[model samples]
Target chain A: MKAQRIASLTFTALAIAYLAGAFFIKEPPLRQQLGPDAFPKTIGVMMLVLSLLYVRIEFQRQPVKEDDERAAIIGAEEKLSDYVDYKTIGIMLALMLGYGLAFESLGYPLATFLMFMAGIYVLDLKHWKRDLIIAIIASFGIYFLFRYALRVNLPIGVLKFLFR
Target chain B: MDIWNNIVLGFSVAVTPFNLFLAFVGVFLGTVIGVLPGIGPMTGIALLIPITFGLPPNSAIILMAGIYYGAMYGGSTTSILVNAPGESSSVVTCIDGFEMAKKGRAGPALAAAAIGSFIAGTFATIMLMILGPAIAQFALNFGPPEYFALMFAGLTVVTSLAGRSLVKALLATTIGLAISTIGIDLQSGVSRYTFGNLEMLDGLEFLVVAIGLFALSEVLANLADMRQAVMERLSIKGGLWLTKEDWKRAIPAFIRGTLSGFFVGGLAGAGAAVASFVSYGIEKSTGKHKEELGHGAIEGVAGPEAANNAAAGGAMIHLLCLGIPGSGTTAIMLGALLMLGLQPGPLLFQQQPDFVWGLIASMYIGNVMLLVLNLPLVGMWVKILDIPLYLLVLFIILFSFLGVYTVNNSVQDLLLMVGFGIIGYILRRLDIPAAPIILAMVLGDLMEQALRQSLIISDGSLGIFVTRPISLILLILAAISITNPYWGQLGAFFRRIFGQKTAA
Candidate 1:
């Protein structure tokens, strides 16, 4: 119920922002009957109405009791921390972001190798040797597959000397 | 005679060594993807789109189509073996399939699933061959108003069936349509919401969003619940041959399942998962050995396995004939078609007969390949499950990055994909369905175009949508779909009013 309320509020804000943006869209000199802004404006209004409706419905709904038959059927709502290892996820997110940013500069080989190693370490720290082997093989293997078989151009970066 | 000629041409194209090889590769990879849980056909197709960048559009679609149906065939493997359904559509298979494995009838259970899938796939493909052209011909008469109404109905049906909450599903859809409106408006050549980023000018690529939403989000969700998937070694003692008694019970179930699956799958938003569940229900009520269903009936496995594979074929009908996808995977397939510079509606059949027919022909051959792979190579496929989960997750992430990067080689796109991935994760936590978002995004541009064109034709009159019979009927269907969640309340309300009147 709390999640629904939060989501509704978020969408309501988004709808308002979107409407404001739609309003500011410049009307073309020779605009068609339905201009470029028409679709977005209509969608924005619909979203706003729906978001408000969502808020109303969430508020009107009775909370499920522990002993309720519906509670048994639907089961208890799970907390995020109960199932998810947020620490691992956060590490992964940072690694992926860094990998993307470094992809061209460090090239595919160095960047992918470092990303895989770090990712595997974060996920499973006990097997450093296995992780190292996997990182090297995967990084170089994918590089060769893309470079040779698929003929996709990857950034040479630090690997430019190999071609030379 | 014309149909016969088309079939011949289709076979001629499908039989070419290159196309045949690609079909084999597609089904193989699809089976692997299906055998591994967490990665569905939608993600599988999305992650592989980069490989098809250089191939001809026909070959790429043929390969992807092979994966779509091939996953259906492979989904039953894990269900029977580990009691874990590799695909959502195979959930029913776990009930009886796992029970059969426990009873040492694993071989026959697996065989039933394979044979049923093959039979259902062939039947559905034949039905597609017969109905496809006719439907396309009929839809060729659709005007802009009718097309807009049809797409509107499609989106509503998909949204209504997507999740438990109608508002959340619709909001996701609204967001998708809004995202699609970001690029330069084609009709007027006016920039809508590029926000000064040149990348946004081309609009967000459906492929990028699909990978982020389906692939990356799936990975993140799995990471949260990370645990070692333990597989108990179950040996298939007997040969894979089904007893005559098994065949007798299963044959009817297969027939029933295929029929139900094909028709249900043709409906927008009803895909293999729904069809499989529906088939299971039918088998439970109507099968000869209905009492033995959950315990270990061959019909239980036969029915749903057939239904899912048949649904894969059934989904192709709407995608090929009407240009509307029946499910998330097919929606991605539609995006692929559009990306390949091929329009998938009525004109596609006339213009790209070989491509359409070749795909149809490949399904038949692909079904055979899946059967051969599943039967004798079942052991090898099961071994794939033994791969460490951490490694699997890492590779999925790497491949997703590679696939998105290869699209434009732009770091901005990668960041955008990451951003959507975060949104997808949040939405997942919020219990919002992501499939509707992709479905809406893929169809959004076309829906807007159709709506604008209809308005132009009607000279800005809103009555144009209601004036046309087909358009009006479709709008009615959309209304029905939107009101679907409230139908029980509506029925109760009507009953109360009528009861009061009767009492008075």
Candidate 2:
């Protein structure tokens, strides 16, 4: 069943590829009859033929039995407690969003410090004071490395007034 | 005398303080990225491509090349320690190296791998230094039809070994080709597959597709099964030195693997993965520790490691000589070259000899640096893995976003990056191999341009590819390889005539 689903998806993707190629292309001059459209059209045609072949071959095979039990087993393996670790997607997303928002507004030194702090905090770092100190130092160090040494064009952010 | 002078000139450019530093950075970051499961040299180099864009072309190539070599060394680390391989080339290492780690012989296993890699790498580097120009000259004869045939053969070979339905891989390849069309046509400057979006007019960057498909999908897959992967034997114990018996057993396998890999990986273009598997198979069939094969044989680690590194060297053959990347990692490197507006081929050797030769020389220097880097730096890599997964993922996503956005400072690119991530996840869930898709996309444009150019030169005759001696030989080899496996009885008959026996 999963294989069948995947096969269908591939077919759809190929169709999109073909449609895009055929619709968007233009004709070339007689001297250059192939034009920009020729390669794309060829690939699209190849995909269309291949997708039909795939559907034919797969549909002829015995349909895979969808097992609710197997799905249950997989779900059971993913305990909510395990999903709550520092590796959780939610935490990662939050940290990234925060970093993105803060970086340009808070200046490199301060923003990087906060981002590092948030990064370790999301990692469940218990030593808050130590984390704060290390984050500030590392942030400043990286900022200096990129900005001063490498001459990178890092954002100075809107916090220049406070630092000044 | 001219060649010697060129070599001296290449060395002078390559050994500059900045280029040397860039080389070190590339390899160092490559090794780290390679150690991560589901990440490989392609992604490592892809991420670095943008970073190098602002630099000089030679410096950019040097950095990208370092990442390629560094990733090779880094791939073995995960296999040796965690029983997971980020790249196909390192998969065989997991068999013996992981078993050795389980049995408290991690040190010897790692030592053998390091030594074997150094030996094979040094040997292959020497071969590259001597044979590169000749091979480049030979490949100069490849015309459009020949290149198309070569790419077709590569596609077939990759699909054949894709570990699933060949039809699916072919489908994926076509889909990638289709995606390659989704922007302004290079020749006519007309839009294709834009769905009316201006961002699609530029077509999708292979970099975005590669990162989304490999890195983002990998993260999602890992997220779905986070429990099993949280921690797998956190600490590894054993000295970092190899014993006498370990050395004695590993040395022969190393030599055999190097030669075997250089030949197979060079001609078949199957890359390091096949080389590693073939080496492991040979060691098991012929070595004294046949019984100990899966149970932590030192020969297993040494042979595959040598094969993989030698294959890395051999893979460079296609890249330098023919301008075709034999493996996924090299494809990313090729993409980098294209973005730099430098076409890769025999012309590259002639037009940019300093750039080409200097890049090659940097590889030799980079390999030595990687050996020194990996030996004492094992602990650092181990600690890196232990960093909080959320934080790690967070930084990866953040940096990726920042990197893409900063390139053009456009939010549209970021949205495209996210969209590609979704597509990547979908492809992964379907078990479609991302490698072929990216390969097709990377080479598709160039192949198209070449085809058109050749036709113009030939006044619309298809005989140009067939008339070239070199191209004909390649096409014949491709045909034979494709048919050889199907004609089992014929193969057996020929083997018997030659006094050779078939394996059961």
lDDT of each: 0.86, 0.72
RMSD (Å) per prediction = 2.7, 6.2
Every model's DockQ, to 2 decimals? 0.45, 0.25
Docking class of 1: acceptable
Position B396, candidate 2: lDDT: 56
Off by over 4 Å in 2: A6-10, A20-24, A29-31, A62-149, A152-164, B1-4, B234-238, B461-464, B467-469, B476-504
Per-residue CA lDDT of model 1 for B63-152, tens digit only, reads: 998888888888899899888787778888999999999999999999999999999999989998999999999999999999999999
lDDT: which candidate is best? 1
Give the per-residue lDDT of model 2 (tens digit) for B1-504: 767876787888889999999989988898888777656777667666668867888999889878877787888888888887767788888888999999998888888888888888877777876788888887787767778767766656655444345566778777777777678877777777787887778888777777666666555555545645655753568688888888889999999889888877655676787788889989989998889998999999999889888888887877777788787778878887887877787777888889888987788888899889888778788766765554555445645655665566555665566567657755665655677888878877766777777677778776776787766676676676555444766877788877744443
Error of 1 at B268 (Å): 5.3
State which docking tier applies to candidate 2.
Answer: acceptable
DockQ of candidate model 1: 0.45
Interface RMSD of 1: 4.1
